[model samples]
Target: MEYISFYNGNEMPIVGLGTFRVENNDECKASVKHAIESGFTHIDTAMIYENEDKVGEGIAEGLAATGLKRSDLFITSKLWLADYGRENVAEAYETSLKKLGLDYLDLYLMHWPGTDEAVMIDTWQGMEDLYKENKVKNIGVSNFNVEHLEALLAQVSIKPVINQVEFHPYLLQASLNRYLDVQNIHMESWSPLMNAQILEDETVKAIAKEVGKSPAQVIIRWNIEHGVVVIPKSVTPSRIEENLEVFDFSLTAEQIERLDKLNENSRIGPDPVEYSGH
Candidate 1:
């Protein structure tokens, strides 16, 4: 597995298992456990996903099965908009940590940008406090654009370590990518496969054929080569292992450009900036 060192000197696995809509309790637990056994130490979950308890159970089982310590894994969870407040930030973090059966999270992210920047900034201060207290090792934001990041950075002492967003061959997120690179903040691609929508694209299929990999692998490699973290969600054990099989090969520059040129600036998830829940 490849790791990208955040500006804070903390390292996160470039690839992780995204538990978004994995609602079945047994499947979620099994998926988490299987992922760890499959050499994926980084598991991403969120409060809104409503599967943290099962994920935590899987972590326990994976640990007992492999004799791996808690520190051996890089676990991440997110804070939803409903739970974004100065006092509520820590409250939500505690609740998520408890649900995950973890003392501290490797990374914690503000799940969305929401509509109001003030609440976002206030919520970020709480995260900064958690970092100071060592309750969470890393803090970041998801679905945030450059404007949101700039406002939050102006009010807070620590900038976010990364920004998680919907990025795929269809939604390349180029402008945001350039800004993040300049800020020394890392970028993570959620729904990197575009909900499996891009897998059938001719360009994607063509490259997959050329590399002797699945279309999913080609899309993932595209994100990896772009220097962005990729989290492709799956519950099937075989698919889970297949997703992790991306590190063995690489996409050439020409192929990456072909995938990049397929961009339509589309999204399969909610827009954090326009989301009104917060």
Candidate 2:
């Protein structure tokens, strides 16, 4: 698997399995287990996903099935909004760790940027403390825009290693990506396929046809080629295996530009600026 090396010398898989709406415990467990068994070394989930117990089961089973050590995998979980208070952060993280049945997480992220600046800063402080104490290997935030990133950066000591956001062919956020590049913060893609919406896009279909790959593969590869880490979620066994098969082929410069120009700045999740919380 291809990896993006961070500034601190750690590495993350370019492709990972995202667990967002996999609410059903059994299915979530099976999907994660299947993913690991199919050679996936990276797994992304959050406390709000509400299926950490099952994800833990899958991880246990997957490791046992593949004889892979815990250190061989990169596991990430997030701190939810309700758990944003300075004192609440550790308890929330421990709860997730308990449910995930893991001793520690490879990466931890603030799930969103609420409107409260102080709360956000406090939450980040907790994350930084965790990182400094070696409770987590890395810390980041999801759905944070430039303004929020600036606010958090000004208040925190260790800068967030990554900022994950909704990105796909339809919503490129080129300017934000450039800003992330300048700030030395890695930009990771959450809904890289736009909930499979990009899979049916005409340009994506054409490119897939030209490359003899599925539209999903084409879009996923496009995200990776853009230097964005992508986590394409799938519960289906075939698609889980298919999503990871993007390492062999390469998208041409022209094809990459074609996909790049498809961005309309659309979003499927809440805008960071306006979203207060759930």
Candidate 3:
């Protein structure tokens, strides 16, 4: 497995399993178990996913099935909007940790940048506290744009190690990607596959045929080659295994340029600026 070393010197698997809509306990548990059993070392979940307990169950079962210790895996969860305040953020982390049956998280992120900048600043303080207290190994933000990142960086003592966003061939986010690169912040892709839309694209399909790989593999390899961490979610055991098989092949510079040109600035998820949930 490939790893991305954070600014703080912590390394996480470049590829991970994302649990977003895996709503039910039984399915979530089984999916996580299957992922680990299929050789996945990193798992991503969130407080909003409402399956932390089941995810915890899956982690327990996966560890038991694979004989892997807690330290052998990298687990991540996010703080929901409702838990944005300084008082509530740490509590939210504790609740997620308790639900996941773990004492410390490998990484914890602010799910979104709330509308109010001051509130987000306080939220960062809470996350910083968690890091100081040894409750989380690293802290980051998801769905944040350039303005949000600048605000946070200007006031905070610790810089976020990552800025996970809705990145794919369709929504390239080139400007944000460049900003993050300059800041030395890693970019993580939440919907790296664009919910299967990219699989049907003519260009992607043509590239897949040329490379003798699946469309999913081609897209995933593109993200990896761009130095972006990708978490492609799948409940199907075969796909969970297949998503990890992207390490074998390499995409040529021309092919990568072709894929890069497919960007249209489209988004499958909510826009961070207008999204004001709490």
Model 3: per-residue Cα lDDT over 51-77, one tens digit each: 899999999999999999999999999
RMSD values for the candidates in order, in angstroms, are: 1.0, 0.8, 0.9
Report how far off residue 87 is in candidate 1 (Å): 1.2
Evaluate model 2: give its lDDT.
0.91
State the TM-score for model 3: 0.98
For candidate 2, write residues 1-278 as lDDT tens digits: 99998878899998999999998478999999999999999999999889999999999999999999999999999998989978888899999999999999989999988989999998888888888889988989999998898888787789888999999887888888998999888999988888887788889999999999999999889988988999999999999999999999999999999998987888898998888776
Candidate topping lDDT: 3
lDDT by residue (tens digit), candidate 1, 222-267? 8889989999999999999999999899988899999899988777
State residue 144's C-alpha deviation in candidate 1, in Å.
0.5
Off by over 4 Å in 2: none
What lDDT is reached at residue 74 by model 3?
95
The CA lDDT of each predicted structure is: 0.91, 0.91, 0.93
TM-score of each: 0.98, 0.98, 0.98
